[model samples]
Target: MVYAPIHESLPGPISPSDRIESIDALRGVALLGVLAINLVTEFRVSIFQHFLPAALPASSLDRAVETVLMLAVDMKAFALFSLLFGVGLAIQFEHLAANSRRALLLFRRLLVLLIFGLIHLCLIWNGDILTAYAIAGLVVLPFLFGPRWLLLAGAAAFLGLYLTMQVWSPPGLFPSLASIQSNVEEANRVYATGNFGEVLAFRLREIALILPLHIYVFPRTLGLFLLGAFVWRSGVLQKPNHVLLFTAGAGCVGLGAAMILLRAGNAMAGTSFGVLATPAGTILLALGYGAIIIAIASSARGNALLGWAAPLGRMAFTNYLAQSVIFGWIFYGYGLGLFGHLGAAEALAIGLVVYVAQVIFSGWWLGRHRYGPVEWLWRTLMYGTPQPLLRAGLNDSGQRAA
Candidate 1:
């Protein structure tokens, strides 16, 4: 079923010179979408409120915006990010010479990421995906060496478990308006007025809430990772073609549309159907988005425009942390204390503005440096040695010695 050139006979791992620009562009795009959804949380709004009618009253425009975002952005963005992480692991595994070496490196990488996630959750923000990705990375490690069918089966099993839980789980336990309002009020009070210690305590409580959902979220994340690995093993991304890209893009969009229609009659905010369909639709849409971005990046003019994202993508680790730091200052008590004051539309606008600025800053930094500051640190820590940071004479991929 693979539609690209096979790399079975390749001599060694793909060099940095062989980096995929489309993947980078897609990651950059996913980052923006992630920020879109995260803005709601950062603004101290209860995302559960979107599902519960009795929570804080939102403006009609806010509800409309939330609906649009739920349909298009929410889970889809994170799914894309998860897929990319798997693709990265696959690429790294391909490049390494030995399984032991690969495992060691990956373990180190994931461990570092876990630490970063903890820091982010405890100090910067409670919603950190890096920790989840790290956990999922561990969950997916066993399948990396297995056949493609085995990986697919594992993904299917995980997804099936999630669906089953959603179908049979009691909907009554879903967040009530009273509960949602209480949490929102507490979050606003702590985040907008509390000291650092108080903020940390509030974040820990939020993380505690997230822990129970890992039963579903972890498996979903692992499944997407395996799917990404499958894509890489199939050699689809390596040999991007117009026909394949179009078909993938169209098929995913079609599937997502169908799923959305299935749940159209129900209020999607907190219903079981919403739980199942939302992720399913978003997963399909995210695939379609990846395909479309690949198509665009394969073209000349489109590639030129999308290339802006490559630098941003390359520095994604740095930019992601930067976002937490910057947004924390803007919205939290220690800084501007603007929490609970902004609407969906206003928060989204701010996210876009910040993203654009990150893109520009990423480009400027990459032009002078081999890697983003945090990326350099990450590599250094993973390898237990100093990694080059300057790019005096290095090439675009920054793999060449300066």
Candidate 2:
């Protein structure tokens, strides 16, 4: 009897030519969801205090916008991003494992990513998720080759810690308005008028306060990575049977929506379960959204309609970092200083405009370049050799020239 590693036994990696470009499009969709939530939440206020009603707009339009964001996005967006990123990591490993010094290469890629994350968290925005993702990636490194059952079990065990925490209602783990009221007030004034040093200091303060929250969430993130890799090993993303996709999509939507609705009912009734209901609901809905996105993008008509986001997805890392830079300048004290100024509706509108610009720019840039600027940098560092960047390096078939 012979044993093969999970990746080797799986359907095997899809080649670039045979790649499902729609996955990139789906990533773009997830990115937009994240943008929508961030504009009204973190961009306007610190993630630490955004939960306070005093921190957000209170008008009817703002109310409506918040409702939509809460129901449709909020936690769902980042969940989807994590899942996609996990899949990307697994696929990359599959492609690299056959080559020389694969694990070392992955470590280099993650190290570079961690550096980028640290830069974003300290300099650009304190709400950065890249650092979390990079850390999660490091933890997930060995699990990429683990057995499929072990992957699922690891995800469950880690995620259960979060579920337990939410139900247990740990102090400081989940910030309350009372605890954050002063921080909110000080942050409002400081973030708007404070100098760069002042702003950095306040951000650092919040980082200390939020460290526990991050610690709690980190395990869930690591679990999601394993879940993503497990799903990738199943080969559903690249070579799906439509029936299975539809079944999973439909079931997930039904169950996830039910969980959310129950949570809402609990909120109305002032039950403790409402707050506890969010984590599982959001994760399930995100998974459902992923399945549906792949299903839609798999179709001919859906491809044409949704293809605009493909470039943005292809350049996800570049666009994500660029968004932090653009929005940070727009809202932070060092730039336009619009913190706590924009209404929720206006903030979301601005976010949409930025997203549109990204879509257009990504498409234009990819037409002439083989990789987005950051992707080029990442690959260059990963391989210790500068990878080709220009489309001119391509053969007539639009594939890279050997």
Candidate 3:
């Protein structure tokens, strides 16, 4: 879901110490969660629906695991990631004082994102989020300069809109097939026999529909963005001493999880109330996520676990792309041809394996390199200069010191 291009150079000071490990760690966690959900997508339907079935064995244990993942990661990651994007935007604007130049910078960034998104959609997969994000980010650009209250108000409206849209969304958004054999046969053709052009056409069609109907995602994103801004403005992210923050987060996690559990049985119905409840639950879950990060940052201060997650967060874009590549290989006809073969439980197992590998790989790679491979490329493109890619131990550029 990473979009936008790097400017030849971003103006203003890029501070070394401005980094916050807590936020980075939380981002790392969110990235893994996103992967968990995406794994299911790659293994299941062309659209985000329940139209497909698991090719793997379906045991009660597996079903329970699938249910949990659907609850925790499916709706949660987008909210968390969107909030982070908003926070990042606020930070970026603060770095460069509001001006036509800043607007130009953001526009260029969006353009780059659009280009990358198109590539991802056409070549990698049709169910790309970068394109949607680029569109939404552009939609809210004018409001970026608006007052905090206005931003919050915009977010509230979007949240309501998203809730309403969920009401109408199809169960699992996948078409119900008359038989498993027919569905699998069709999926095989798309994944195995179909060419990129056909995939693009199908994808673009979905994107067109999603744009108007998914307007709600923007408001939800905006609201989280405003919340992040408020936190940043209030110094909560940096300070980490707000007891109320922890309390609110705990309340959100506790209450939100319970509410989700309560409503989950109805999730497959595509009913109005289910959609509203899911987003509502997601908001509370996001609060809990933020609070936990703040609390951990406060206590850990400079612990090793946070340090480990920090590198993953720093190279999140690289990691996210890597995930798409890996999942495609695993589930697409190009690899094991496991598409539509794994059950939800099996998909979760595969997701866990992928997540573990990424954590280890990210930790090890960061130890020797200045940046994750893609991150280095992005930075070089953004700065229009070659950036150091390897650490020089002590007294080096310190980019890899994390």
Q: Which candidate comes out best when scored by TM-score?
A: 2
Model 3 lDDT per residue over 1-402, tens place: 223333434453243345677777888888877877777654454443354553433678766766777787676887888888777767766766744478776676666777777787767765577776777778777766878777667777776666665666544543235543453455556664455465445445555434443444655766676666555655677667657768888899888787687677764346555556667888889779868765775565534546666778877878888777787777666566676667767777887787778888988997887678876775565544566676653223233232
User: What does candidate 3 score on TM?
Assistant: 0.81
- TM-scores of all models? 0.88, 0.90, 0.81
What overall lDDT goes with each candidate model?
A: 0.77, 0.80, 0.67
- Clashes per prediction? 1, 0, 8
Model 1 lDDT, residue 117, Cα: 82
Task: Tell me how candidate 1 scores on lDDT.
Answer: 0.77
Two-way TM-score contest, 1 vs 2, winner: 2
| C-alpha lDDT of candidate 2 relative to the true structure | 0.80
Question: lDDT: which is higher, 2 or 3?
Answer: 2
TM-score-best of 1 and 3:
1
What's the TM for model 1?
0.88
Off by over 4 Å in 2: 1-18, 53-56, 169-179, 267-275, 396-402
Residue 112 C-alpha lDDT in model 3: 70
For model 2, residues 79-149, the per-residue Cα lDDT tens digits are 88888888888888887877677788788778899998999888878888888888889989988877888
Q: Who is ahead in TM-score, 2 or 3?
A: 2
The order by descending TM-score is: 2, 1, 3
| Total clashes in model 3, counting residue pairs 3 or more apart in sequence or in different chains | 8
